[model samples]
Structure formats: C-alpha cells, structure tokens
Target chain A: AQTVTQSQPEMSVQEAETVTLSCTYDTSESDYYLFWYKQPPSRQMILVIRQEAYKQQNATENRFSVNFQKAAKSFSLKISDSQLGDAAMYFCAYNANNAGNMLTFGGGTRLMVKP
Target chain B: DVKVTQSSRYLVKRTGEKVFLECVQDMDHENMFWYRQDPGLGLRLIYFSYDVKMKEKGDIPEGYSVSREKKERFSLILESASTNQTSMYLCASRYPGPYNEQFFGPGTRLTVL
Candidate 1:
C-alpha cells in the first residue's frame, strides 16, 4: 500500500510572495509519478504540476515548481509570486505500478493568500 | 479542451433513500473515476471504470456502487444513502496509459439528511 502525507493542515502567504507546501509519501515502487492539484472555492480541481520519478530535474510550470527528492521520498510544491487566486486546497498525489491509473492523495493543505 | 460534467452541482437526500450521481466526459477517454472528498481528507476513490461495463472498487468502496453502460458516462449509486455518505463527489476521466493527467468535473455536493 502507498500513502501520501501532507502534514500542514493550513498555510498562509502574502500576495506576491513565495510559499512552499510540503509533501511526503511512502511507496515501495521505484518508478512512479507525483502530482500537485489545486482546488479552489469553485470546487474544481486543477492540475498545478507533475514530476516523473525518473527525472532528476525538478518540474516547473510558470510560477509553480516542485522540489522532488526521490531518495528522501519528498515532493514539495513551491509557489512563487503567489496571488490571491493561488489560495486553495493543495493536494499531493502519487501513482505507481499496478495502481490501475488511480491516484493516492494526501490529506491536503488549505492555503490562504493575504493581500 | 477536455470537459467532464456532473448531472447536478448540489443534491439533498434523506437517509435510506436511493441516490444516483451521474458523470459524463467529452474527451473520449477510456478511463473514468469516482471520488469523494471531505474536510481534511483529500480525495478518496470510490469506484472506477476502465471500459464500458467494467468497474473496479477503489480505496473506499463500501456503501457505494457504480454503473457504466457507456464509455463516456459513469454513475455512482448509494443504495441506501446514509449521513456518513454526505460529501462532495467528483468525476474524472483520462487516457488508458500511465502518467496521463486526469481531467476532473466541477463536483457534486451531496447531503444526506
């Protein structure tokens, strides 16, 4: 069994600043995929970024980047230049071998962006 | 753009009532999924269908059933809706391969009284 853990229940950041959301997972599979999804007040889940376990380089999407440490089993999301729209529930997910295309998600972190 | 839509955005039902949540995807995806979200608990898969007429149980399949008569639509059913079943239901679809991102619907907020 695999588990994704997001320890921070809530987080806050000032607008235009940077914030990092921590995530860790327990998986035995060496090959896998990590993802971060943002859920806003509209109740829509949006993809933030994705990182392949085989890739040594971190995954980045505009202001959203990931610090993926495969050896440490840690994948963190770094949001630079945070805006009000960035305030949402962030989830860290894991997908691995024989998982049947299913995603294991963390408890989620509620982020609030302050003006 | 891929679009996944649910039949309803909000629903209220009483205990022991039969509840059905419908989901439809427009991207011609082969895989469809049903998940329930609660406060503090991210998203837990309730059921998934890989193809038409094929369904699989997820992490929390208890008290939940699903239907997939067609490839584009997946239905989640609660034979006897309970108060514990009240939560946000989400539908998603994706390609049949690994690493493909799953497109999500707006979600249905179900309340069981």
Candidate 2:
C-alpha cells in the first residue's frame, strides 16, 4: 500500500510571489508517477502537472513545476508568480506504473494567494 | 477535451433512504472510479469499474455499492443512507493505460439527514 503525506494543511502566498507545497510518499516501486491536482471552491478538479519517476529532470509547466526526489520519496509542487486563480486546494497523488492502478492522494494543502 | 459529469451537484436525503449517484463520461473511457471527498481527508476511493459489468472494491467500499451496466456510466448506490455517508462524491474516468490521466467530474455533494 502506498501512502502520500502532505504535512501542511494550509499555505498562503502573496500574489506574484512563489510558493512551494510539500509532499512525501511511501512506495517500493521504482517506476511510478507523481501528480499535482488543483480544485477550486465548488469547481472541478484539474491536473496541474505530472512527473515520471524515471525522468531525472523536474517537470515544469508554465508557472507550475515539481521537485521530484525519488530517493527521498519526496515530490513537491512549486508555483511561481502565483495569482488569485492559484488559490485552491492542491493535492499530491501517486500512481504506480501498472494498469488499472488507482491514484493514492495526500491529505491536500489549501493554497491561498493573497493580493 | 474529456468531460465527466455527475448526475447532481447537490442532493439531500433522509436516513434509510435509497440513494443513487450517477456519473457519465463523454469520452469512451474503459475505466471509471467513484470517490468521496471530505475536509482534511482529501479523497477516498469507494469503487471502480474497469469495464461494463466489472467492478472492483477500492480503499473504502463499505457502506457503498456500485453498478456499471454501461461502459460510459458508473453509478454509486447507498442502500441505506446514513449520516456518515454524507459527503462530496466525485466521479472520474480514464482510458485504459498506465500513464493516462484520470478526468474528474464536478462532484455531487450529498447530505443525509
């Protein structure tokens, strides 16, 4: 069983600043996938970014990037130039490289972007 | 664009009442999932279906049942609604593949009083 942990329950950042959301997971598998999902208040959940364990280079998408440390079992999301739209509940998820495997998610971090 | 839609955005039911939450996906995804979201608990998987008439128990399958007679639709059922079952229910679908991302619905907030 894999478990993802997000130690921070809530995080806040000033608009145009940068913020990092921490995540850690326990998995014995070498090849897997890590993902960040954002869900605004009463809105649909959307994928922000994803990182493959085999890829050494961190994944970057626009202002959202991930710090994926396979050895430490840590995968964190960094949001640069945060805007009000970035204010949402962020979740870290782990997926094993196997068919029909469901995603294991963390407790989630509520991000607040202040103006 | 993949779109997953739930039957309702909000629902209210009384204890012991039979409740059914429907989910449909526009894409012909072979895999469908049902999850419940609660504050401080992120989302917990309740059930999943790989194909039509094929169902699998997820992390928290107790107090819930699912029906999938069609490939594009998955239904979550509460035989006897309880207060503990009141929560936001989410539906998701994804193509049959290891690296494919799961597309989520807007979610249905159910209240059992």
Candidate 3:
C-alpha cells in the first residue's frame, strides 16, 4: 500500500513571497505518479502540479513547481509569488503505476497567505 | 471544461436513516470516484467506478455502498447513517490515462444527527 505523509500541519507565507510544502511517501513500486492539490474553503480539490517518478526533471505550472526526489521518496511543492487566493488546504497524493488512477492523499497542510 | 456536480451542497440525516449522494459528470470520463474528507484526514476514497454498473471498493468502503447506473453518474449510499459518517463527500472524474487530472465537484457536507 502506498501512503503519503505531509509533515507540516499548517504554514503561512506573505503575499508575493515563495513557500514550499514538504511531502514524502512510502511505496515499493519503481514507477508512480505524484500530485499536489489545493482545496479552498469552497472544498473543491484543484490540481496544482504533478510529477512522474520516471522524470527526474521537476514539473512546473506557472508559479507552482515540484521538487521530486525519487531516490529519497520525497516530492515537495514550491509556490512562488504566493497570492491571497492561495490560502487553502494543500494535499499531496500518490498513485501506483498499475493502480486505477485512484489517489492516496496525505493529511494535508493548511496554507495561509498573509497580506 | 470538465464539470462534476453533486446532488446537494449540504445534507442532514438522522442516525439509522438511509442517505444517498448523487454525482454527475459531463466530461464522459471513464472513471468516477467518491471520497470522504475529514479534518486533518485528507481525502479518503470510499468507492470508484470504471464503467457503468461497475464499482470497486477503495481504502474505506465499510458502511458505504455505491451504484453506477449510467456512465456519467455515480451514487454513494449509506445504508445506515452514523455520527462517524458525518463528513464532506467529494466526487471526481478523470479519463483513463497516465496523465490523470481529475475534475472535482463542489462537495456535499453530510451531517448525521
């Protein structure tokens, strides 16, 4: 079974500053997928970024990027130029190579963007 | 744009009563999923369907059942509601591919009294 763990329960960042959310997972599979999702008060799970285990190069979407350390089993999300709208609950998820794309999510980290 | 919609935004059910949560997606996705969100407990999968009339148990399937009569619709049923079942329910849909970007519904907050 694959499990994702987010060590930080909560974090705060000033607007326009950068923040990094840490995530680690336990999986025996050699190939898998990792994702970061954001859920605001609206409770909509929005995809932030994604990384494939086979790709050593990190994934980036505008201001959002991932630092994927496959050997270390760590995938961290870096949010640059944080905005007030960035305040939300962030989740790190894992999916095995053969699984049905069903995600195993972390406990989540609540991010607060300060003005 | 893909859209996933739930039947309700908020629901209150009594203990021992039956509860049904409906989810519909317009993107013709081959997969649909139901998950429960709890404080400090991320999103836990309850059930999922790969096709019409096909349902699979997820991490936490106890006390929950699902039905998929149509390709675009998936329903989560609680045979007997319990206080422990009170939580936010989310529905998501995604295509069957390596690049899985699921579209999520607004979620239904179910409260068991």
Candidate 4:
C-alpha cells in the first residue's frame, strides 16, 4: 500500500511570487508516476504537473514544476510567478505502473494567493 | 477534448432513500471510476468498472454499488442513504492502459439528511 503525505495543510504566497508545496510518499515500486492536481472552489480537479520516478530531471509545465527526489521519496510542487488563480487545494498523487490503475492521493494543501 | 458528465451538480436526499448518481463519458473510455471526496480525506475510490457489467470494489465500497449497463455510462447507487454518505462524488474515465490520464467530471455534491 502506497501513501502520499502533504505535511502543510495551508500555504500562502504573494502575487507574482513563488511557492512550494511539500509532498512525500512511501512506495516500494521502482517505477511509478507522481502527479500534482489542483482543485479550485469549483471542485474540479485539474492536472498541474507530472514526474516519472525513473527520470532524474524534474518536470516543468508553464509556471508549475516538480522537485522529484526519488531517493528521499519526496516530490514537491513549485509554482513560480504565482497568480490569484493559483489559489486552490493542491494534492500530490502516486500511481504505480500496474493493472490497478488506481491513484493514491495526499491529504492536500490549500494554497492562498495574496494581492 | 475528453468530457465526463455527471447527472447532477447537487442532490439532496433523506435517510434510507435510494439514491442513484449517473455518469457518462464522451471519449469512449473503457475504464470508469467513482470517488468520494471529504473535507480532510482527499479522495477515496468507491467503485470502478473496466467494461460493461464488469465492476470492481475500490478502497471504500461499504454502502455503495455501481452499474455499468453501457460502456459510456456508469451509475453509482446507494441502497440506503445515510448521513455519513454525504459528500462530493466525482466520476472519471480513462483508457484501458497504464500511465493514462483519467478525465474527471464536474462532480455532484450529495447531501443526505
């Protein structure tokens, strides 16, 4: 059983600044996928970024990037040039390359952007 | 663009009443999933279907049942609605392979009183 943990329950960042949300997971599988999802007040979950465990380089998408440390079992999401629209509940998810196709999600970190 | 649609955005039901939540996908995905989201619990899978009439129990399937009569549509049923079952229900669909992204619906917020 894989478990993802987001230690920070709430995080706030000023507009145009940068913010980082921490995430850690426990998994024995060598190859897996890590994902960061954002949920606004609308309750719609949207994909932010993804990182493959096998890849040594971090993944970057627009202003969203991930600091993936496979050895430390840490995958953190970094949002650069944060905007008001970035305010939401961010979740870290883990999925193994198997038949289950089920995603294990972290508790979530609520991000707030201050103008 | 993949689109998953849930039947209702919000629903209210009484205790012991039978409740049915419907979901439909337009991408012709072979896998559909039902999940419940609580305040602090993130999201928990309730049920999933790989094919028509082929359903599997997820992590939490105690008071929930599902039906996939057709490939595009999947339905979740609460035989006896309880107050504890009130939460935001989400429906998602994806292809039948590993590492594929699952498309999600807008979600239905159910309230059992």
Candidate 5:
C-alpha cells in the first residue's frame, strides 16, 4: 500500500510571495505519478500540478510547480507570486502504475494567502 | 472540458435512512470514483468503477455500496446511514490511462443526524 504524508497541516504565505508545501510518500514501485490538488472553500477541487516519476524535470503550471525527488520519495509543491485565489486546501496524491488509477492522498495542507 | 457533477450539493438525513448519491460525467470516461472528504483527512476513496456494471472497493468501503449501470454515471449508496457517515462526498472521473488527471465534482455535503 502506498501512503502520502503532508507533515504541515497549515501554511500561510503573503500575497506575491513564494511558498512551498512539503509532501512525502512511501511506495516501492518505480513507475508512479504524483499530483497536487487545490480545493477552495465551497468550491470544486482542481488539479494544481502533476509530476511523473520517470521525468526528472519538475512540472509547472503558471505559478504552481513541483519539486519531485524520486530517490527521497518526496514531492513538494511551490507557489510563486501567490495570489489570494491560492488560498485553499492542498492535497498531495500518489498513484502507482499498477494501482488501477486509484490515488492515495495525504492529510492535506490548508494554504492561506495573506494580503 | 471534462465535467463531473454530483446529484446534490447538500443533503440531510436521519440515522437508519437510506441515502443515495449520484454522480454523472459528460466525457464518457471509463473510470469513475467515489471519495469521502473530512477535515484533516484529505480524501479517502470509498469505491470506484472501471467500466459499466463494474465496481471495486477502495480503501474505505465499509458501510458503502456503489452501482455503475452505465459508463457515465456512478451511484453511491448507504443502506443505513449513520452519524459517522456524515461528510463531504466527492465524485471524480478520468480516462483509463497513466497520465490523465481525474476531474472532480463540486461535492455533496451530507449530514446524518
């Protein structure tokens, strides 16, 4: 079984600043996927970024990027030029290649972007 | 754009009542999933379906049953609702592939009193 852990329960960042949310997972499979999802209050959950284990380069989408360290089993999300809209609950998820698309998620980190 | 929609955004029911949560996807995705979300606990999979009429138990399937009579719709049922079952239920769907991301619904917040 794969387990994702987000040690930080909550994180705060000033608007226009940068913030990094930590995530770690336990999985024996070499082929897997990692993702970060964001859910705002009373809003739908949306994908923030994703990283493929085989890809050494991190994934980035606008202000969101991931620091994927396969050897350390760590995948962290970094938000640059953070905006108020970035304030949401962020989740780190793992899905092994053979896991049939079922994702194991971490406890989640609540991000607060202060103005 | 892919869209996953749940039947209701909010629901209230009493203990022992039968509860049904419906999920529909417009993209004709072969995979659908049901998950429960609670504070401090990101999201726990309850059930998932890979195809029509095929359902699989997830990490926490206890007290929950699912039906997937069609490829685009998946239903989650609580035969006897309990207070412990009160939580935000989320529905997601994705294509059967390694790199595709799952699309999520707005979620249904159920309260069992």
Candidate 6:
C-alpha cells in the first residue's frame, strides 16, 4: 500500500509571494505518478500539476511547479506569484502504474492567500 | 472537456434511510470511482467500477454498495444510512490507461441526521 503525507495542515502566503507545500509518499514501485489537486470553496477538484516518477526534471505549469525527488520519496508543490484566488485546499496524490487508476491522497494542506 | 456530474449537490436524510447517489460521465470513460471526503481524512475511495456491471471494492466499502448497469452511469447506495456516513461524496472518472488524469464532479454533501 502507498501512503502520501502532507505534514502541514494549513499554510498562508501573502499576495504576489511564493509558497511551497511539502508532500512525501511511500511506494516500492518504480513507476508511478504524482499529482497536486486544488479544491476551492465551490467544492470542485481541479488538477494543479503532475509529475512522472521516471522523469528527473520537475513538472512546471505556469505558476505551479513540483519539486520531485524520487530518491527521497518527496514531491512538493510550489506556487509562485500567488493570488487571492489561489486559496484552496491542496491535495497530494500518488498512483502506481499497476494500481488500476486508484489514487492515494495525502491529508491535504489548506492554503490561504493574504492580501 | 471531460465532465463528471453528480445527481445532487446537497442531500439530507435520516438515519436508517436508504440513500442513492447517482453519477454520470459524458466522456465515456471505462473507469468510475466514488469517494468520500472529510476534514483531516482527505479522500477515501468507497467503490469503483472498471466497466459496465463490473465493480470493485476500494479502501472503504463498508456500509456502501455500488451499481454500474450502464457504462456512463454509476450509482452509490447506502442500504441503511448512518450518521457516520455523512460526508461530501465525490464522483470521478478516468480512462483505463497508464497515468491518465481523473476528472471529478462538483461533489454531493450528504447529511445524515
């Protein structure tokens, strides 16, 4: 079984600043995928960014990027130029290649953007 | 765009009542999933269906049953709703390939009193 952990329960970032949310996972499989999802008050889950375990280079999507360290079993999400609209609950998820598309999610980190 | 729709956004039921939560996907995805979200618990998978009439038990399947008679529709049923079953229910769908992204619905918040 794979488990994802987000140590931080809540985080706050000033407007136009940068923030990093930490995530770690335990998995024995060599092939897997990591993702960060954002859920706003609307209760809609949205994909932020994704990283492939085999890729050495980190994944970047506009202002959202991931620092993926496969050896350390760490995948952290970094948000730059954060805005008020960025406030949401962020979840880190792990899925193995053979898991049949079932996602294992972390406890989640609630992000607050301060003006 | 892929869209996953749940039948209701909010529902209230009494304990011991039979509850049905419906989910539909327009993407014709082969895989559909039902999950419950709670504070500090993240999202726990309740059930999943890989194909029409094919169901699988996920991490938490107790007190929950699912039906997938049609490819695009998957239903989650609570034979006897309990107060512990009150939570935000989410429906998701994904393609049956490696590293495919799962599309999620808006979610249904159920309250069992």
Which prediction has more favorable lDDT, 3 or 4? 3
Best by DockQ: 5
* TM-score, prediction 3: 0.98
TM agreement with the true structure for every prediction: 0.98, 0.98, 0.98, 0.97, 0.98, 0.98
Pull out the clashing pairs in model 2.
none
Off by over 4 Å in 1: none
Candidate 5, A36-90: lDDT as tens digits: 9999988989888998899999999988898999999999999999999999999
Instruction: Report the lDDT of model 2 for residue B38.
Output: 91
The DockQ scores of all candidates, in the order shown, are 0.71, 0.69, 0.71, 0.62, 0.79, 0.69
Alpha carbon lDDT of each predicted model = 0.94, 0.93, 0.93, 0.92, 0.94, 0.94
User: Against the true structure, what is model 5's DockQ?
Assistant: 0.79
Clashing residue pairs in candidate 1 (N, C-alpha, C atoms within 3 angstroms)? none
Candidate 5 predicts chain B with a TM-score of 0.98
lDDT of 2 by residue, A9-42 (tens): 9999999999999999999999888999999988
Q: Clashes in model 3: which pairs?
A: none
Error of 1 at B22 (Å): 0.2
TM-score-better candidate, 2 vs 4:
2
Residue A84 accuracy (lDDT) in model 2: 98
Q: Which runs of model 4 end up more than 4 angstroms from their true locations?
A: none
Interface RMSD of each: 1.3, 1.5, 1.5, 1.6, 1.0, 1.2
Write candidate 6's Cα lDDT for A48-103 as tens digits. 99988889999999999999999999999999999999999999999998887689
* Model 4 TM-score, all chains together: 0.97
TM-score of the second chain of model 2 compared to its true counterpart? 0.97
